[model samples]
Target: MLVGIPLDQSNNTVKPKECASEMSAYIVEVAETRCKRSFAKVFNYFAPRLRSYALKQMGNEALAMELVQDTMSNVWQKAHLFNAEKGSPSTWIFTIARNIRFDMLRKLQNRKEDVCSDDLWPILCEQTADANEASLDQQVTLEQIGYMFESLPVKQKAVIEAIYIDGKSQQEVADELTIPLGTVKSRTRLALQRLKGMLHDND
Candidate 1:
């Protein structure tokens, strides 16, 4: 959902200046303008995922709910502190979740409720940093691929759109276009080659 439409890093757009990561653009918007609509989008998307993550770590529905609420509160409060150069939005958000989990567990331990620090599994900040790097790279690459689709020749674009975007099989595309399957395959292959060359040149 976050990947398809690249925006222009404004209230009305998604593309950021340095990177076209959608979440990052959203975060930056929240930071600069305190836009509740953007914050709500962030909340709606990440809340359930954070609840699942917190439930896995804490093994309690109540704690999971708490984590989701607290983590999102921190996200809104600290959105201005987000540095997109360091890690993706995922890592930043999860790091907040991890810290909240730690604090929750630590408090439980203080009450002597059988929780122990030794049993805790904290998400390593560095590890998540690397993971988010790969994630950010993948997002940018996908955006570039979207750009590539705009440059395809008309016939090739039709074929590629039918197969990939419209989720039609090659045979289906062949029948729809009244062309043989072999011709469909050839057009697909040539369109892919052009996209490959574009990728290489961009690199």
Candidate 2:
């Protein structure tokens, strides 16, 4: 029988449990005995990558950083429940982040649909913007979009067109771009970032 010493700063005693209790007990002990160091080590290992993932998902740097911090905080609070038999710490942490993001997105009820209809409207239609100014603004918007398109890296431009203009599914864009699905996802995300910047600049 192996006698495990408590190492964590917060809980310097063994936790009683049946199967795989030793590993759980070890983590709990380490955390209780060395709470600061344990949390620091875990944060260092996961924060940067998790922050980048959150930024890609949220499209906002400050919010992304908040999400990452929230994730790490949860990991610290829930560390006692971690089971090596189920998954590694990295996997467990990422799963928590993913769930948090999903919950956040679900709660955001103000989502706007991005798809546009390309069908031409009849000229004998309801009056919208003033004809002359609307025509000028439309021309300016097109010119601005064209300039922004030219500024994008080729891969980013292609992904934007496939999704916004050609109406491709993300999977289809991944296949056509010959990039891994995750790469495709990230590139598309950054492409939207660029577009937002460009549009804001024009405005």
Candidate 3:
């Protein structure tokens, strides 16, 4: 969807610029040439994502949308300052969004808070809990290695799974599989090499 309000309000305000470049450069030229339609189109394209990003950081949808509008307005007014050679259009636009977010946070800090301190603790704890869950998830990923170990040929897969996943020694796996020690070693090595090649080829 196009971002922000419809172009009916902003397009008629500017003239069109010639040629296209990065988004930042395009925005600058559009504003300079008074290309109202182009300006509105560009604003719409970027507004939704920008709003979502702002809201994620600020925890307020309305405020984020306001910031998106403000950022677009700034883009129109300050397009001339954009330098295409230095960065991509999206990067430049995002930088503007980021700056706006930081400014809003700073402004919020100056105002007195109405909410009780106890009300904020849950939100803070939620954030902390999210971090903890993510850490636990990393340790849980031992199963991915287990799955990879299991998904091999019966002998090759069995020997590797027994030795690695099941915590058996090489001699134990060989004895269990009733294969020679050297045969077990050879199969494990060949299986690993083939797995690596398959993975690299997939990439």
Candidate 4:
């Protein structure tokens, strides 16, 4: 009962109850050689469904569209990995979509946790100190820390600020900075290391 848009020999689109195996075979063709028509057929059939699925999960039209685009791009790239014997084409594509959605959700959760994290400023005051002394120590320590942070390399400083101060996930920072996630992580790590060295030298 699966209704699909199938292209006939005349290049006419027809609604047919196509078997999943046939669709999978077409994907195999796409894998072996780049076939624009075959891919178009697959895109026509699956893109809207993937979009709807993403919309329901993400609840944002723009993000859902992005999800669909990313999922389809993955499909095109990984077409060779699709095995009909292991799973149907629909199952494989939906699995990719599911994984993408899960990753997005995980990143969103990370951003939320980062927003609430206390790691932005180290606890520098002794608990044994009086309240007034602790307050003054904290103020001085925070000022020094801020100065050190500002001294970091521009890219490193930007990464740390986005992640820790702005509560943005690494992915968000990457997108904002037009850099890769690995770059964001590397800059943050290097920034922290340099900041630690500066603090140690001062002490």
Candidate 5:
């Protein structure tokens, strides 16, 4: 495993869960022995990516870094709770970061409650399903989403990535992209429809 976080990992789209068994071992070691090396490996590999993801969502370097710290702290504290059968570390870690970002957004957008991130992008939950209860837990891995998101048209994809993956408000996306708010909304709606159809077709 890498001992230090790289300057950039944009080209390494497939690395996160590609070695799930290996990463899982690191997580286990961190849990059982509190090994700093193992935890460092996890932090070294994921911290950069998590920061980038958080930066996109939160739109500030300092806030993005906070998300990374908070997420790694949770991974350290909750490693024993991880279940490999349910999801890989990438999924678990990113989900934690996303939920944290959600809370951060909620705080930041106190005046914009009429426009919500959850309405634009559904949050992924890692809960196990009950014996008699159905759940909407996404089994789709980050790699799958990376490829699927790339399939969108340039305009629609930009809007979707900004509002959906990045956790931006529709108005924020519109302002950043210099497009009309209605155009952002229209593209987002169309993009989601296509994405849901693609997901069902995959199923």
Candidate 6:
């Protein structure tokens, strides 16, 4: 079922640029008044592209469709959080879609892991190292890494996230970002070098 109220557009033939402008305006309306017609317009425009994005990530048609639905639901609920000054509507919507896909994958992984069995086996093993100490070290390391990540330039950060966090190949990242493959590689290398330097400093 479509989640937003439908708007009448029987006589309108919106050009691409006009449609983008309209979407931005509609998002603002949705934020200000929870306008269903505006939300519907945004959903109608973005839902198909979002579905294709999900399909590429998970390769499942049903799951992809579900992701699109959930992403739109998020847009409806969190419209107020969107700021046009920070990014475009497409970027905001695609970021939501990416996060939802990540959540779905994480949930699937959690379901596959039998926590009880995992805990039992770990307890049964001979404990040579201190698990608590190791865990604390890992937590600290992750926190430092996150800080380092935030320090990278926007383009470098985006390249690293696409290649590593989002698990996309260099070519895929380049294609998605509309950059050359060589630029993607160079950014990834530079980002990694900086991160490694930060890590080494911590050590």
Candidate-wise lDDT, in order: 0.78, 0.66, 0.67, 0.75, 0.79, 0.78
Whichever of 2 and 6 has more TM-score, that candidate is 6
lDDT (0-100) at residue 128 of candidate 5?
38
| lDDT of each residue in 94-132, candidate 4, tens digit only | 877876776677677775442211132211112342346
Model 6 worst lDDT window (10 residues): 116-125
In angstroms, how far off is 156's CA in candidate 4?
46
- Sort the candidates on lDDT, descending order: 5, 1, 6, 4, 3, 2
Write down the worst ten-residue block by lDDT for model 1: 122-131
- Candidate 3 lDDT over 1-203, as tens digits, reads 75553654333234323212534555766858967656776776678768888888888888888889977887787676666677655666777777676657767788554443224332111233223433322232456555655677887887777777689989998888788999989988988986666555544
Residue-by-residue lDDT tens digits, candidate 6, 99-132: 6676588686776532332133321223444455
Model 4 alpha-carbon drift over 4 Å, by segment: 1-17, 111-203
| Global CA lDDT computed for model 1 | 0.78
Q: Against the true structure, what is each candidate's TM-score?
A: 0.46, 0.40, 0.43, 0.47, 0.48, 0.49
What order do candidates take by TM-score, descending?
6, 5, 4, 1, 3, 2
Q: Candidate 1 has which clashing residue pairs, if any?
A: 7-14, 7-15
- Best by lDDT, which number? 5
lDDT of 2 by residue, 49-168 (tens): 798899999999887998898787777776765666775555666677876776566556555533211113211223454446433322346877888888999988888889899999
Model 5 spans > 4 angstroms off: 1-18, 111-203
Runs in model 2 deviating more than 4 A are 1-34, 110-203
Candidate 1 segments exceeding 4 Å error:
1-20, 111-203
Ranking 2 against 5 by lDDT, winner: 5
Tens digits of per-residue lDDT for model 5 on 151-170? Answer: 98999999988876789999
144: Cα error in model 3, Å = 69
State candidate 6's TM-score.
0.49
On the 0 to 100 scale, the lDDT of residue 200 in model 4 is 77
